[model samples]
Target chain A: MKIDLENLTIKKAHEAMKNGGFSARELAQAYLNNIDKDLNAFIVVFDDVLEQADEADKRFKDGTAELLTGIPIAVKNNILIKGKKTTAGSKILENYKATYDATVIKRLKEKGVVFIGGTNLDEFAMGSSTENSAFGVTKNPHDKTRVPGGSSGGSAVAVASNYALVALGSETGGSIRQPASFCGVVGLKSTYGAVSRYGAAALGSSLDQISPLGKNIEDVEIVFDCIKGEDKMDSTSIPDKIYKEAEKDVNENKKIIGIPRHFLKEGIDKEVLENFENSVNKFKELGYKIKEIELPNIEYSLAIYYILMPSEASTNLARYDGMRFGFLKEGENLLGDYMKTKGEGFGKEVRRRIILGTYVLSAGYYDAYYNKAQVLRKMIRKEILKAFENVDAIITPTTPTPAFKIGERTKDPVQMYLADIFTVPANITNIPAISIPSGFVNMDGKELPLGLQIMTPHMQEKLLFKISREVLS
Target chain B: MEIKDIENLAKLSRIELSDDEKKELLGEMDSILGFVEQIQKVETGENVSEAGDLVNVMRSDEDTHESGVFTDDILAEVPKVENGFVKVKKIL
Candidate 1:
């Protein structure tokens, strides 16, 4: 039977399997056949994919299948699946295999989701484009000359290109949302601590969140619900009681959306601005009120992210010395061995960030860079929370522009960083945010996708999902 | 930022770079630092407390898994493993 890969959602697939329209193996094979090698979306298409689908088929046969049973999903390479090679898109750990599963991977495995493959990412989730990947860049499915945004570029491509039903991506700053915007998909970055981080490669410990990207809002929400919860393995994971308490404060009648017009004054593409205004008008037509709000300290969000992320990243990356694991290069002495191994193993962007991180945390500069950024981070979070008191959710264009060409911003690190300007504030404040495909813009004679980002107060993912559904519908 | 500062950072980060690479990094790091320098200009006022509440989560000290269950698996990824120990260069 021919499955409609483009319109397939988790619900539709599940109902089809239950009604014997097609077996799990047949559905999985349809997606497997759709995987295109030219896109470079996957680092490794798992050899055991069919075997995993066969197991899901058994669940359906035994009347024990759950909603996620037989669903084929792509995972970001930074996320570890036990006994699989988990390179966070760096040469250092290119051959290293995970010894255990990440908490999210374990949960999905329990739900009978088929592990399709490990998708490519920026090394340590550092860069804004997948161009930094040691394995070649993932091209935007819409236009092969353009890049799929990163560091979750590969996962976003997997969903957008119909290679998988849904995909998991990790975000530190704009990693997940930016790519989803570029690929015209729905991406959700759950509130910090809403999902467990254990067994995922650490980039920025304070900022990283495992997220989901899919073809639409409901599919993203379904995958999020299956994987989110407090875990004993992750101390930062928020307990259910906190989410329960936060749910009490949710005003069901609130329909006012806040747009920080001051933040959108410059650097945004004219077409993207027009699309954003149209999205706002659509909301107004749907009986929702739109208000111009001010977040006074939001301009510093990118600066704070650069300081805090690299500081944490350098500290986190210190573990990859020659003796323990990963690539090793011997030298005349111990220090030389460490230097040679790291110098040769890490890519240019990874090395640059590590050095930047080290400099910020170094003795004389620590107070000036790292500590000041932290204090400002607090101010930004407070300002955002204050805005939430007057608004239901804050909205913005997911990115300043559409998917850029592969090598357009590679030479200029600052230009690449600016791509994330609109998306970083959510990560800075640890709020729940999502990017949904709003519309398209004709760039260079190609209609590229643009995304609308909606952010709610911390742990308010349900509100984001509700508003996202309204916008998309 | 100076070339000497870049050298110092390389030494501190334990990543060796060629002289040409170091020269290239010097320019790149300068721009990146300049971009992030906006934070230093913000008047954070008197109260400079860090963001978010810090809480100490405690759990009983006990073995959650069987001893040595993952010893081989952990050692398998090591670059050099010898007789159940990770082999490394002599410090002295």
Candidate 2:
């Protein structure tokens, strides 16, 4: 039977397999048939994809098939799948293979999901565009000339271009949401501890969260449910009791959404702003009350992110010395080995962030930059939590603009960082946020997709999914 | 940001940088530092608490995996491994 790759969801795929519409192997093959190399969406399509699907098929025959039994999914390269080449889109780990599965990967394996391949990402999941990837940039499926957004660019492209049913991406700030926005798909950046980070390569330990991107909100939600939970391996993973408590506190249906109008005053593209206004009006039309709330410290989110992210990143990335694993460059002595290995292995953006992190954490400048940013981060989080006391969720344009041309902002790092302005607040506050395809904008005679980001209070993923489905409905 | 500052940071970071790369990093770091400098002006209140609750999560002192169960797999990825141990340059 011919598979409808364009419109397939996890539920639909499972149903089809149960009803004898197609075998899991056939479904997996259909997605494999759609892989386009020029998009650079996948670094390596796993050779055992069909084998995994066949296992799913056997489970179906034995009446033990799970919801994700036959579902094919792409994983961001940072996530480990045991023995697979997990590059994280850096030359440093270009040939490095994961020795064990990430907690999320291990969970999905239990559910019998098909592993499609490892997707591309910015080096160590840094940078706003896939351009930072030493492998190559992942082009936007909508317009090949434009980027697919980064760190999770390849995963976003996988879902958008029908290379997989759904994909996993890791977010540090806007890594997951912005790419999902630009690719016109649904992406979720779960609350910081909602998902375990056991085997995913560390970026900013405080900010990084393994997330899901899918063609629709339901698909994203399904994948999230399968992978999210507390793990003994990841101490930072939130326990089930926290989510249960958060669920109890959530109001049944206030349907109130907060818009930080003061924060959206400048730097947003005109078309994108117009589209956002339309989304807010749509929420109003759907029996939702919209309030223009003030998050006083919200504007400083990107600045705070830049300071804190690098500090964490520099500390996290300090483990890439030559001896144990990954790329090794020998030099005259131990220090030279570290210096040469890192200098040559890491890409330009990775090097820049490391330096920036070192400077921020340095003796003379620590209090002014790093310490101050941490204090302000608390203020921003408090303000957001206060706003949530009145409103169910906060809404914003996922990106300041849509997918930009490949080389457009590569020359200017700050210009690229601005693309994440609206998305970083969610990460900073450790709140659950999602980006859903809102509408489209005509740019340069091509219709580019835009996304609306919805952020809810901590661990309120149920509310986040409910509101997202309503917004997309 | 000066070239000396960039050099110092690179030294602290343990990443080598050439003169040309240092020049490029100098300009880039200047702009990045300039952007992040905005937070310095904001006066956070004296009572600004830490970001989140800090809890110590401790696991029992027990072996989770069998000894040498993963030794081969772990050693396989190492750049140089000898006798089931990762080989490194001599310190002395």
Candidate 3:
């Protein structure tokens, strides 16, 4: 009964529910009561909490409930839930209610998952920390002076602080995994095109992906199974025709994991390096062979990410002009209205990316910037594919450092982007990756949580989950 | 990028950025562009990496759909329709 709704992983709660100890409403009330008090972790807790709880209660009572039945989940503000005010931690759409449920919302609703509320995030998922959010930065629940990692910072804190039993986060350039790492939780960035992007606001469209944030591996897999698969509305969605679960007896096999030898060369914090080595040692103890793999191009992940990401983001965000459905014009002329609305509505980081995106994709620069990034992206993907042939999965640190102060990197955008150093590589190459809390670091007498990131080949999510669940348990 | 330059880019992007926003964005733009510029320095050996691989993603000019689209005729269904469209304001 004393379970902090924020810290309790969904898998533990579900196991308890399956045993018939607590009813659905009881679980829903635990989360709702916390949301009403902890205004720091959540933005807008759902108003119809009771109704969804009642529905879930019915399904559970009749023995027809889904795995997520009666479980309370919080969604990052970027993902749409029907009639919910999904702000994406931005003022431009602060008052805009979602007209339609995102594909993830629709799927979760059908399976008796009760949405508790929307959590805060960096505006458009742009920052390494939540300070870039217009909604005010989401504080690290572990230490208030520090930050929760962003742009999925709120989703991370929701689970870390027990504000919600589990939460959903989107990852583009380490948003989900980094936040999860900072908050000491489980986060997964599904393979590109694995989940439908029907209603989520696009940041860097090419890299933007819907993913899950949970307390642990089992919980992440449950949410992943519920929300994944193709949707007609999302053209990028890949059909779930090729999924296979790794056997529970997978430990007996002499599995090989690739470790980018070059990743250890520069910029990694000592704590990060130590934690990674300890994780590798643990994996070896579990009878897995660690292969020192050469991915020379892996060092260039951030360079490629910024180029392709901004270009795609520039195109994806072009629809939010002041004259259209969301934030629109209120000036003397059409162009004036657009200028004023977007100028006032967007924050500094958002505008910076927009300009960068436009400049790269503009006249006389398309072939040189955009097209060439494509060719390089293929080379990187090919390297990952070749690496997979020698190893079942790739292992790396989720982030280079732990959580820093609120404004530590606000002045330098490159410093912020460096936080994605580890997670972004998996995204650029279209692979499934998970970040699990490995240990905490003592940085000058401060405790910082670190994450061990495990990545599997394209669409090899079951194998990814199998490895993560081992480390998590 | 200068503040003025950022304002111009905002116009091209169709988002209204305020003066304060412009000043702040100018600072951010300098750093983002500075980082992106480093990619220009990284040796790719005659191949530069782009942002996406959807090289030939083609959406054909297929037959027009009949559902969920707002046409002039559909706008006429609203009792407050104006100028053959669903209209709202006349602000100066």
User: Which predicted model would earn the best lDDT?
Assistant: 1
lDDT for A295 in candidate 3 is: 85
Looking at model 2 chain A, report the run of 10 residues with the lowest lDDT sum. A245-254
lDDT of 1: 0.93
Give TM-scores for every candidate, taking all chains together and pairing residue i with residue i.
Answer: 0.98, 0.98, 0.89
A126-239: candidate 3 lDDT, tens digit per residue: 888888888787888777788889889888988877767789999888899999999999899999988988899998777778999988777888898889987767778875
Candidate 1 residue lDDT tens string, A1-473 = 78999999999999999899898899889999999999999998999889999999999999999999999999999999999989899899999899999999999999999999999998888888899999989999999999999999999999999889999999999999999999999999999999999989999999999989999888999999999999988998999998889878777677999999999998999999999999999999999999899999899999899999989989999998878888999999899999999999999998999999999999999889988898898899989999988899999999999999999999999999999999999998999999999989998889899999999999888888988888788
Q: Candidate 1 chain A: minimum summed lDDT over ten consecutive residues — where?
A: A245-254
lDDT score of model 3?
A: 0.79
- The residue-by-residue lDDT of candidate 2 on A1-473, one tens digit each, is 67888888889899999999999999999999999999999998999999999999999999999898989999999999998999888888888999999999999999999999999988888977899999989899999999999889999999999999999999999999999999999999999999999999998988889989998888888889988988988888999887788779766685989999999989999999999999999998999999989999899999999999999999999999878889999889888999999999999999999999999999989988888998998899889989988888899999999999999999899999999999999999999999999999999999999999999989888888888888788
Off by over 4 Å in 3: A1-12, A15-19, A36-39, A244-254, B1-7, B15-27, B41-92
Candidate 1 deviant stretches above 4 angstroms: B50-55
lDDT of 2 by residue, B1-92 (tens): 78888888899999999899999998998899899888878988564554477767887768477777998888889999888778888888
Output DockQ, candidate 2.
0.80
lDDT of 1 by residue, B1-92 (tens): 88999999999999999999999999999899999998878898655554377767776678478889999999999998889998888888
**Which TM-score values does chain B get in all models?**
0.81, 0.83, 0.51
- Rank list by DockQ: 2, 1, 3
Error at A235, model 2, angstroms:
1.1
Single-chain TM-score of chain A, each candidate: 0.99, 0.99, 0.95
